[model samples]
Target: MGISENINEILLDIKKLSPYPEKVNLVAVTKYVDVETVKEVLKSGAHILGENKVQVLTKKHDELWDYSVNHKWHFIGNLQKNKVKYIAQFIDMVHSINKLSLAQEIDKRAQEHNRVIDVLIEINLFQEDSKEGYDYQDFLNDIPALLTLKNIKIKGLMTMAPYTDNEDLLRNGFKKLRDLKDELNTLYFNDSLTELSMGMSNDYKIALEEGATLIRVGSKIFE
Candidate 1:
């Protein structure tokens, strides 16, 4: 199937999972894909695209600036401090902010650009050895300090489930993220922490079922 067909099919499947499909944001992951394919995804009505690396995102942002005016670009990978400046100007949101220092750097760059950057707090739900995110208790303990930052807005939480075929583990991971969001909302008494940026191509349906408002899918659409 073509890019357009794949997107259409994914959108259809998303609708089946929720009564209000429009609420679920589909961020088409464009990492490792060509600009042509990215354009095809945009042409197919997908307005949000995510990239895992700043260099690639920068190249594409420059090359496709005209085509990207109406689209939202997201940084969905482990971001290095030095690379934050490169993406601060154009990235719509950063989905993997795992530490206060990184968030501070992002805010510094965003202030220089005179833009308020939106970010999601990445939670290490399963305590994976390889993942980058804040542990549950640490995140809670740091909320007050995080709220003090001026140039960045905390939109919500993000998480990655372990790569496995076990349905129970996947669902539990997603559910924990949803529960965490709920806990934070009640603690803060605000709904501004609204986005649950969980899920990927392999397990988006489960993510949606567990209350993921934003999902990132790549190979499923681009390959």
Candidate 2:
């Protein structure tokens, strides 16, 4: 099957799991693909594209200028403070605001661009040493500080489950993220936290079952 077919299949699967399929955003991860492939993805009907690197995203944004009005760009990797300026102008949503300092920098850049940026606080649910995100307890402690940043709207939480075939582990991880989002909204953000960027190509189905509003899928769609 081609990109279009893959997207259709994924959308169908999403509909199977989610009652409100329209609310689930399918972000086609285009980090490994070239501009031509990305254009094909957009043409295939996956209008929301996610890029991991600032340089690649900037380059693709320029090359795919015509799709700007209809498509949106999401920064899905570990965003650096300095690199925030490059994407601030066009990034529709950032799925990994990992630290307080990074949030401050995004706020500054968004202010410079005269636009408020949408962002998700990345939570290291399992305390993985390899991951770049706030520890679960740390994030809870810093909620007040994160809320103080005026230019970036905290959409919700994002997490990448460990790459394992264990279905139970995946479901639990995704559930934890969903619960955290609900807790944060009820206690701190007042139900404003909406998007849960939890799923990827590997465990997106489980993530969707648990309540993932945004799922980042790459190789599956491109293959």
Candidate 3:
């Protein structure tokens, strides 16, 4: 299988541009793309893969049956408490850990599977009434609730900037998440909350510039 040169080029570019140690986890979002395509991406040296829907991920996870390396799977979409068991089984990380109840379920399921699940708390930057993310104002109040959840460990904060092309809004939103991570870190998490998961294919570079330790990229690579 041949790897995508275009994707590799972008990864090379991103790897070089990142100032912090090459420690960031570049999650290759494989939503619309095919499993064989992802295999080629894996061949291109991508260790982590991200999926949006649990059902879709379940299929992808089964289809990619024999990847030999440390291929980690990440759930990057809104996860319901009911789907916790399936996700905890194979996903190495969960990026959209929203409700505290969902987090509790994940902790319980992960513990059942004897695994430590890494998670990123999602904050709704757009403030959309329909969106499922912790609001900025309520964040401090919710910290204790988040900490009490079991088995799952918070790696950092994740936020999806409103779907707009506004550079200013994007910057401020990304910066806010970074700042939130800093504020959260001022306290201790025993395990440590060190990752700031922001940005996608469109604004990942800006996110990297703003201290995002994890970038969930899709179309840029999968296309």
| Per-model TM against the reference | 0.96, 0.97, 0.91
Clashing pairs for predicted structure model 1, backbone only: none
lDDT of 1 by residue, 151-196 (tens): 9999999998887888899999988898889889889727778899
Q: Give the Cα lDDT of each candidate.
A: 0.89, 0.89, 0.80
Clashes of each: 0, 0, 0
Measured on C-alpha atoms, candidate 2 has an lDDT of 0.89
- Model 1 has a clash total of 0
**Better by TM-score, candidate 3 or 2:** 2
Q: For residues 57-154, write the lDDT of model 3, one tens digit per residue.
A: 98989988576756889898899888777768778889887777778889899889888899988999778887778876677677788788668888
Runs with alpha carbons beyond 4 Å of true place in candidate 1 = none
TM-score order, best first, reads: 2, 1, 3
**Per-residue lDDT of 88 in model 2:** 92
The Cα RMSD of model 3 versus the native structure comes to 2.2
Ten contiguous residues minimizing lDDT sum, candidate 1: 13-22
